[model samples]
Target: MTERHHILSDNAAALSDDAYDSDGFLIEEDGDDTSRPRLYDGDQLEREERAALRRVAGLSTELEDVTEVEYRQLRLERVVLASVWSEGTLEDAENSLRELAALAETAGALVLEGVVQRRQKPDTATYLGKGKAEELRDIVIAEGADTVICDTELAPSQRRALEDVVKVKVIDRTALILDIFAQHAKSREGKAQVELAQLQYLLPRLRGWGESMSRQAGGQAAGGQGMGSRGPGETKIELDRRRINSRIAKLRRDISGMKTHRETKRGSRRANAIPSVAIAGYTNAGKSSLLNRLTGAGVLVQNQLFATLDPTVRRSETPEGREFTLADTVGFVRQLPHQLVEAFRSTLEEVADSDLLLHVVDGSHPDPEGQISAVRAVLADVDAADVKEVIVVNKADIADPEVLDRIRRHEKHSIAVSARTGEGIEELRQLIAEELPQPDIDVDVLVPYDRGDLVSRLHEEGEVLASEHVGNGTRVTAKVNADLAAELAAYRA
Candidate 1:
């Protein structure tokens, strides 16, 4: 058997059972049953509902005898993480496995154990070598683990080979992430995009065995099967693939339509010259918390990865009363599935089109720099690399001072802030105001009293330097966009 090892502390292996109720809502544990009912908004209620339905442990129904062409659901329970250290240091491999553990937990699985193999490269036939694979099987059996999650994306053949040896279901990082997205996606577009990515990932990996997968249909071969089974037909796998393809096509169309609606809203914002700032970073890096801190958006804030899959856009104002929209986007991760990037291209475009990006980083993480690199890689994939960035080192209240100093020193336009404790938030706000796009055209306009809407627009869409009321109308001097400048041309003073 593989040597017994604790990938994480015992506390990290399982979440505190008392922290949440059976419905997944946080309940004060003062041992009082007579407390008032906690009030939750719609979003919070939906999130709690999703959490309540999370997969239970030891409930996975995957058959042990089925090795080939098994249809696996992400009903992960009692999982063992496996990784091969090819290039990075041993610490890096451990960190990767730890992250995998967090991911499994986020997907509602209990992490039993983890193992890392020091290989120059992953084995071709099996992810781990033959001996190591057997050892892993032994570990799984000993720990009663039903799933083995590889740290890297596994090819179909490799996954099959690994499962055959391990005698249990095996999945990769990509599928695990996809499953989390599947569970957390709430919006229609978000759900559709996630389904599209899942189908894309599943198409190439579809496999089958035995005559049941065969298309052959005749009197003897059918074994007294009815007339419907007598004709030359496509295999079961083929039918499933075709259905998935059809669903994918329809999802694409639906997502396309939704994309157009999103673009129209964006176009309206552009027309109004409202600046947009997208909060983006690695998963669980406090992007949503920061959004709430800045805008009181009250988005779902959980200590789990990929908790916020649907992008939330909220209108916010800078300290100077200049209005801009802040978008909380889907968090990026290392090796973010390309299928997801393609599927969520429309949503990611919000980042690409933003006036600025608040790249939040977890200052407490051991490998913050690595997380930054991974996020940037995905940003490049979405063509958002060129957008202006303000590195916001979050969790400063609990972060290592040396790590915070290192990050601030390395990033030119970085600020350290704590979303939880409200530390350095004012400085972050000021930094954002400075980094956002500024209106260039200076306008001095005298508007009629009947055109008060113009005055409000001036205050909402541009920086009003000065304003005064005259007998004829209200006179204002401000900097505005070209579009708004044209609207004020007739009233120029």
Candidate 2:
């Protein structure tokens, strides 16, 4: 079934006093009130609070099972969202929840209902307070929600406690995001990295079957059939742990190999003096759309979050025909899962290694500024902080004029453009051309007729404006990078 989310009005009220059952499981408020758990009204919260909650209640998208080595899609889960509004205004909290709703949608869940409670800090045990959790449970029950998605990452104990109370599966922001990555990963290396990250996350969360699972029951008496399996008969959980560890190692090895290949390609580009630019931003900020706009890359462009996982690099040139490469990389998000960061490090290096970064932001988003900060936070993690940036405020056709003004006021070098309509593309291109690193030297040189290779090298490694077939050789006038300028020094005219 197609995925859909329900955004409640901002004025909806919270659950009334009589909404709970004797056992405290949520059930529908209007249904027969038996001793059994009541179904949550699914709209217990006030219109405003409910509006703050972008509950993805109806649609179900397939999810990948992280526990398995092979990629497998699990049944879509029905999820309810819960968030704590400790800091920021109600609008801010609502926006955060809205993003969460999008994430849940991306993970293939029908968001049922969302709730938020005002708290200074999350409870150390339940994330939500005990009372709030019960209320959440009530809502989950009422809606028949199979899963509860928290706005923040939950500690293992916290997660366990929440599950015990809600009687449903619980996942935090990190896991939801990692699941999305696993779903979108397409390439061999991308899959390997995602799996490694999943295992790393799963290793610590693995539940053993008590002390019996920890004890070694080796030898023929224990039904050990293999030569090496005699001394250490592993329990089911132990075997799973071992297998995951082994897979992690192999994945690292595979990723390292892929990294070496990437480096080789980067080296070749460097040798040719091709300038590289990388596009990065918050998830679903239109990075792929922008890349397609600039290069006609025809990459996948979807309305969903994290629609593109693998990096795409295509050769593109400026209006002056200065050749450079444009790479579209995985988008960042607020509190990006650390495991993903480490696993995708090699891929993100494309951004760090670029001569310029086209930081795209959805000017039309409710909080474009927040998106900027989140993307920068991840970029800092990847050590791309020092890379020159040109903030591209995309979606101008639909963006709020006030928001665009706010962006332009604070970001002096920012440009507003609509990637969909091609508006302001020329100005964006010109800005990119101007921001890109320029050649170190411009000179007129005449190469000997016999050494045509040098003339060709000049074209490859420099920006040649004019070349002529002179009596002795080809006369070339061009702007050359420092490396090539040195090589052309002897031929300078």
Candidate 3:
């Protein structure tokens, strides 16, 4: 763990060296031109020559074994990243590639190198142009890389073609995100949802067996098969597909059951009229830390993408002592896979049903506006556009003041907070109290001394504006929900 942290810190430092300019493009470093091709020669090189070139480029040829297998053994993957820029500034392209590298690291991969090609659009067949694809093949062979990850989701043909040319596993951004979710999911429902998404993704990309799986079967007289084997044998691909389909069906049923249970829980919360405030934001935007800061729930806080996949609900009180539930939900990201969104709908419904959304943003990130836009896109997809939102710029301790000021100017109700240092937390709490739904009824009641629980409930669930002791009991003037008002009706003053 310490070693991983050190590696992550080092990577962060490397990423920070390049600064974004006014136009959001990285100012090319002194004595370095990004326009110059990393590979100069137009001719294909021999094996040794390609290896030498890779050595010069500092490429590594190590395959990170995937650790998400049933055995749960820890493994590290070494990967090379490639992206084709169809329409974006060089800096925008670089940022996208860097994000992919971060995702790869979160999935326990050591990033070897990242390469981008300027093009009008990704090649429909190979993602990169033919010449660039060939160049990539040589780079893969020289670097000893076993996998190449593209920055965008690839079509089935594109994936196959890239794999064929590079002679390595080829995956896209969506697959990488899904793998990270698979690693972090802890709860039964989380696990089920991730598995369902994986199956859905796999179902479409499942490869068919070639000639080896197409051999014809013979009858018993030919001594090649029995009565049941008079025709073509079941291809391995077919059997695998059938098994996957069965598992997918089972997962859907299981997820449905989980959804029902979740709805029941939500229904119970509603019946009690406890207002729910859901914390949501881009992945690694300090949401878990914020939740911990607010409620002291002590959730797992990691500086990695999609670190917390399971939802955690913790009880909290506003400054007025009005109790509510704060739910830490799964974070969103740019281009979050559709399969994951559909599969985790039940969990996301928690966000959709919330009385308020505390949309946290990493004010320190280079592209805070982009993060906000991406999160909003996902929220719209889940039909949560109508839900009330309170934009929160967290990590104020380390954020750029200019960025914070800009965000605050644009978002009137936004607050700058540092969950780590406790800066602006009290103000944030007060703001939450002010924004939350207030009690609808004001009541004056005299409770019997024996019914002290009602008074306690009043303090915990309502805003007790005033209180006094009377001979019969306690006289309280408070604003509360309908249920509490009904309970206090018997002792109405």
Candidate 4:
């Protein structure tokens, strides 16, 4: 306990029987050049991480009887991942373990070890069985870990009781996910959403900042402040919660204003009677790449999750020379946080107002069908499932033929294409032109040449079956959508 206390902070050194550096600074690592290929080991670190470990070996207390895991997990807060396989089979347990590993990685936590208990249902007080929870605490102590990452969201009371017993930080799946988002989000809107989720998570986790609250920041409180109070107006954790909430509100307002801007733009397109097509899919499914292929949009192409948060709208002409708006939306993810779905609702509403949905899938992914299911879940959450969709089996170049065949066989509205190689793009464009709603009738008339605006509008916004020119007037024939057909009623061309 004295060693554990020192490892955490200064005031608690007498609990465990080991020595520590008491140095406050963390050894820095280079984050530049994000293009390096990641080498993940289930156990043991890569050479670089091993070198770093050697450097810090003498700086921190060493524990005996620890096993190394395969992953470039270094300088990570050690954590125990616990899960209850309720209604979960062996496969489910393995999958839960894998996902927990990913979550722990994402949260900058090293997986010291993992444990799964089977139960018909979760225990009310201790997510795992009461005895098992005690065993887990012992595991944490043996591994010298100070945190536990649970596989499910724990109720408030359950969280408190478990932390009290475990005497370690315990964060659930949702909270861990939120923390990763907090770390990954770069854009203003993304930050706002992440902070909102974090604050909401903290609001419940704030019962007490756990044992750390008992220690003062630098030394004893100079005045009459309580142990948790430190020397500030509010404790560090409380101030963090308050700051997050304030930032969340500010972000909500900003997102609202941005939403209005989107509405205004939508209204402009609506008034002009120009139809829109929105591209959406699971993260890393090549939505951005498809947008670039379809419209030469020049959207950033990255091989990472949640890379593009800002919506990019570009114009493209169909094979029939008909122009329409193509919009690229943020990618969806498995178990996407509700706060994000809510925060980006306006951006996603672009899908709701679309003329059609280009639902792209990475036919190459091992679980393309599972990705589809995850995406559909999010779409249903936002009430956009009924939108007309064209299934685009993207990444055909690297995808297995069997995988492509499986999707084609299982889904009705599917097309296989390599967005990078331009394979099947022309057919896709022509198909898009055909799937678009047609005008009720083709209007034929001659108009004054001075109304070039009307002539161009007819050409761009409507399908022109024919067009000719006469003295001081232009003769034209075209088919237009219902809305544009109405707006062009006076033009009659």
Give the TM-scores of the predictions, in the order they appear. Answer: 0.83, 0.81, 0.83, 0.72
Give the whole-model CA lDDT for all candidates, comma-separated.
0.84, 0.83, 0.81, 0.71
Better of 1 and 4 by lDDT: 1
Instruction: Mark the regions of model 3 whose C-alpha exceeds 4 Å error after superposition.
Output: 1-75, 214-216, 220-223, 232-234
User: Judged by lDDT against the true structure, how good is candidate 2?
Assistant: 0.83
lDDT computed for candidate 3: 0.81
> Could you give candidate 1's per-residue lDDT for residues 31-87 as a string of tens digits?
666543444443332222222211112322234555421333244477778888666
lDDT of 3 by residue, 1-493 (tens): 1111111111122233445554544443546555321232223322222221111122222345444431332355657888875565656776777788889888977676777765556889999766677888876787567789998999999999988888899999999999999999999999999999999999888786675554456776545567777776676678778899999999999999999999999999888888899999999999999999999999999899999999999999987777889999999988899999999888988999999999999999988988999999989889988888999999999999999999999887799999999999999899888888888799999999999999998988788889999899999999998998998899998
| Best-performing candidate as measured by TM-score | 1
- Residue-level lDDT of model 2, residues 356-418, one tens digit each, is 999999999989999999999899999999999999999999999999999999998899999
What candidate 1 gets wrong by more than 4 Å, as runs, is: 1-76, 226-231
Give the lDDT ranking, best first.
1, 2, 3, 4
Q: Pick the candidate with the highest lDDT.
A: 1
Q: How many backbone collisions does model 2 have? A: 28
Instruction: Rank the candidate models, highest TM-score first.
Output: 1, 3, 2, 4
